[model samples]
Target: MRRWPRIAAWCVAALVLAGAALGSATVYFGWYDVSATGPHTVPVYALLDVASTRSVKLRSADIDVPDLDSPDRIRRGDALYRAQCAQCHGGPGQAPEPYALGLNPAPPPLVTSARERPAAEVFWIIRHGIKMTGMPAWQYRMTDEQIWDVVGYMRVLPTLSPQQYRDGAPSGGPASSLASASTSPSSSATATPPGDMRVGDMRVGDAKAGRAALQQYLCVTCHAIPGVPGARHYVGPSLDGMADRSRIAGVVPNSPDYMQRWLMDPQGIKPGTAMPALGLREQDARDIAAFLQTLSNFE
Candidate 1:
């Protein structure tokens, strides 16, 4: 019995070592096909599917599900889905765009996913997205309320016929509400005056818009940004007390133009810096710079 136990232990150790060696060799020698044109082998696909499914289930286990039967909420989700999701995932009447078709492990139709997965799992997937897949993390671009709306809409997606989908949510619905809400200033949050700050000759950079833009661009992921709700990570230095700093990235003078330039192309000014060039649009760079400038201190 003692001898058998020892043999079993040795066998397990050998197997672990062999698996490690195989993984290392595969990575180093480029033995795995990474091409999107090629589909994953049966075992590989099965393993990945199981892993992703389990991860979503575990993470979403504790999520509090809201009442998704509200007509307003469903309508909002319908509009949002048509605008943001339909192109990639398709809908009752629609096919995914040509580009979405080219993606490896192609984006699944939400109609099927809605029927199969729980609402919490679907919500988590939409908010956080999956790795090594084309699904984007919508948390960056959407609020929690918005994500929930999408989930609500998805629940009803399977029930809609092609004609009903085409007809869309009734007139004077979520679309109009969304438009009005966007134009109207928030009663709670203080509004930044339009063109309160300028970058170069252009009168731009609304602080309120800038703050939202910061969240949209995933800046909160790596840095501890004030006012933006996200993980308290410090992969990059905190943006607090940015206004007190005289230099941008310890290189250029901390002026609006220089700050915008840095936001647009971090690598261009400082070669080999860990900060990636996020391919920010000119207006987005200006907006980000404006938001950073507002960070006076850690308080």
Candidate 2:
């Protein structure tokens, strides 16, 4: 009986080792196709689905869902959804843009997703996007309140007809609403003065906005930016003490103008450099430079 038990243990260990070896070989030999054109195998798809679903469920369990039934909130969410999300995850009776079709794990039509997913799960997914999916983490661009508003809209999306979706939100899109809300008298009362900071002769570079822009532009994916939450990737040099650094990318003087220029067109300044020209807007470059200036020997 003891021998039988020992034999069973040996058999289990052998199976585990065999599985590991097969997996390693598959990876090392590149036998598995990763092309987005093809769909995943049934088992692989099932595994990923379970993993993602469970992850969302586990993480969203403790979320404090606010009352989301207000008409104004839903309208605001509708505008935001149209502006930000509709292109990829189409609205009711709306087709996603052609590009969304090419994505490997096709962006789910939110009409069905909204009906099936819990509010908390949807909110969490929007806030911290799914990895390897085209879905982006909106936390970098949108505030928590804005994300909640989207969630509120999603809760009511299943009930709206295609015509209703078109006629529901404001006409000028979310930009006007977002801009008005940000520049409202109440908000402007506490706004940072134009002269409070400057980057590259631009007085409009807000450090707070710059910080958010860094994440929005996915700079954290490559560089370990101070005060940004992301993987501590070493693909680019850390910007921990950028304020004190004497050179921009070890080429130009680390002045405001040079810094902004470097950010705007890194490849143009230093041809063949690993740094890419991110097509940053002038304001975005200035804001990023201002934010970088705040990273002073605090590593």
Candidate 3:
């Protein structure tokens, strides 16, 4: 027994010595390629990708999400994004700015990243900002609606093209957004904005009223989120769980006040925003904000 124990300790020591020797050789012999041009090996890249996604998702778990599918919200989002985000993230048409590509860990194309994330995760990154990366948190600069719009656009980016992105600028070139819609059902809480600018808290009991207001106002004609069973259309990001987000444009701390302010003048928060001044009243803005807040009850 004593001999076996001694032999086992020697074997362990030998293994450690061999590992250190191998490591020293790898470093001294230039066996490990450190070139940027060399892409990661398949297994290495796969492991890294898994780790990256899990890290983002874990950090994103606490982030509350708002509704990303409304036209007003997305339009406002576009406005803020064009001014700040487009340079790095790019859009359907615009390529990433030079700086974004040159960074060590290249900025993830949001259009592609969305497929891997929940809207809340996207919103969290927008609000909290990432470290050692080109991405910045919009917190303090933009409103909630604006962030949701970017999230909404991201949800359906796979279907966009460079031309559509250029045209989709809210500045009115031609191509407008056509991102994917969430399949989640829109509850009474996720009511659409009213036609005549009536602003107020949405009542679950008044879902019928909210639905009526949605159609009468032509809200669905151009913008469409998942609403009342089976009527979903791809006009906008689905409003499956809008009420839960913590901020807007990944900037503003989510609040009814900020939401209303954004609806009235999204451009004030971000210059060159695509969202137009919609001529909204205080109440109109509030009512719409109320409806949008309901999109993420699940999150």
Winning candidate number (lDDT): 2
Higher-scoring candidate on lDDT, 1 or 3: 1
* Of candidates 3 and 2, the better by TM-score: 2
For each of the candidates, give the backbone clash count: 0, 0, 23
> For candidate 2, lDDT tens digit of each residue in 66-111?
9899999988898788889977766643445546645656566565
Which of the two, 2 or 3, has more lDDT? 2
Instruction: Compute each candidate's TM-score over C-alphas.
Output: 0.54, 0.56, 0.45
Model 2: per-residue Cα lDDT at residue 266: 62
Superposed on all Cα atoms, the candidates' RMSDs to the truth, in angstroms, are 18.4, 17.3, 20.6
Q: Quote the lDDT for 47 in model 3.
A: 64
Task: Quote the positional error of residue 115 for candidate 3 in Å.
Answer: 3.3
Cα lDDT tens digits for candidate 3, 1-299: 68999999999999999999999998899998765333344465456656756788898787777666677766666666677776665554333443453443345445555675688888877876766544677877767666777777677665665545655666432223212111123311133424643335433323334433333222332244345321122333445555676766566877767876765555455434433333443554566666666556575
What lDDT tens digits, residue by residue, belong to model 1 across residues 70-172?
9999989988998899776666534455466556665656665676789999899999999998788999999999999999998898787644565574565
What would the TM-score be for candidate 3 when compared with the true structure?
Answer: 0.45
Provide the lowest-lDDT 10-residue window in model 2.
174-183
The TM-score ranking, best first, is 2, 1, 3
Number of the predicted model whose TM-score against the real structure is largest = 2
> Model 3, which residues run further than 4 Å from truth?
1-44, 129-133, 137-146, 170-299
Alpha carbon deviation, residue 229, candidate 3 (Å): 42
Clashing pairs in 1: none
